[model samples]
Target: SPHIVLSTLTSYCPRSPHIMSAISKAKKSADDARDAAAQVREVLDKIRSALSHHAHDTSLLVRLEGELVAPANDVIRMKTYTETAAKFAGHLKELSEKVGERIQLHEDTPASQRTLNVAFVARTKRNASQIKAVLCQAEDTLDYLHQQALSSYAEVVLEKGARVIEERKEERKEEQNRQGKNQS
Candidate 1:
């Protein structure tokens, strides 16, 4: 078969051993960089998750405060901050996968025994910088989301408190009317 013959010839071809070695080193470096970036993304995801949980807790706290005097229907409202944080985390995860896939480790890599290590180090630094940039952007987004959640929760608590005061006033008015009717 023509295809079989070509495949056999290509397999038997004597490639430069030095070039192969260089390629292997570069591949290893690229893989390491990709792994590092993935780890950084994971850490950032955890940070975002923690922030979301805090937001949830804050909302819950506001709800508890409302329970002391506010009507059941007027209790604090849970804000949408946690969901936003989750979305951001998901985006970061997708980005991490893309970065991992883009890391190309090929056979044409320079020889590891020589100055190739220096090149590898420089490339690694660049990859790290890119990862850091992505993380910074994620942090900024999460911060804004948290702030919105906090404000929403605060507003709910205030509304609940106001509703409770109005209810108390209505009760007092009804009590005064009942006493007047009894005297008549």
Candidate 2:
């Protein structure tokens, strides 16, 4: 009797094209978001590595100063990756919202007449939540890395400035010594 009822409901209730299109878009967005997240993770790892190396050796900061100026450096790459991931995340969020609206529409249907399986709806909700969580994490990581890069750049400038001041002081002392000797 339950099987008969399910068959009758399935035959009578055709799936909406909008719901099908939303599902297709959600799947594609999820795949693209995953790829973007992976790229951002790689950028984060490179930033961590550079920061760790600089921590172990102050001279590495000088090297970082040069790398920062380069076009293809980790900081620049991280920015690009993070931007791309953020775009994908936003798109995915929109798609998930559409899917949620479709699910709500199905849930509103009378129990005996509902075409969507309860378990299927629950699983879809869980998947959307998980994808959002992952993308949020990637964005957070990118923000942290960007901050680190800024801090590193500031330190390098300060170090260079202090060195210049010391050199000028040394030059003044040498000039004074020469003038005194000549007067004597």
Q: Using TM-score, give the best candidate's number.
A: 1
Which pairs clash in the backbone of model 1? 22-109, 23-107, 23-109
lDDT of each: 0.43, 0.44
Question: How displaced is residue 6 in candidate 2, in Å?
Answer: 72
Worst 10 residues of 2 by lDDT: 65-74
lDDT of 2 by residue, 89-180 (tens): 55444534544543464456555543356764465455345434544554565455444444443443344435545656787899999999
Q: Estimate each model's TM-score.
A: 0.45, 0.37
Top lDDT model: 2
- Please give, for residues 1-184, the per-residue lDDT of candidate 1 as tens digits: 2224323333433343443343344334334433433444455654344334532232332333233222211111213344654555555554454345224321234445324566554654454455456557755654555455445434443444355456567878999999999999
lDDT (C-alpha) at residue 177 in model 2: 100
What stretches of model 2 exceed 4 Å from their correct place?
1-115, 179-184
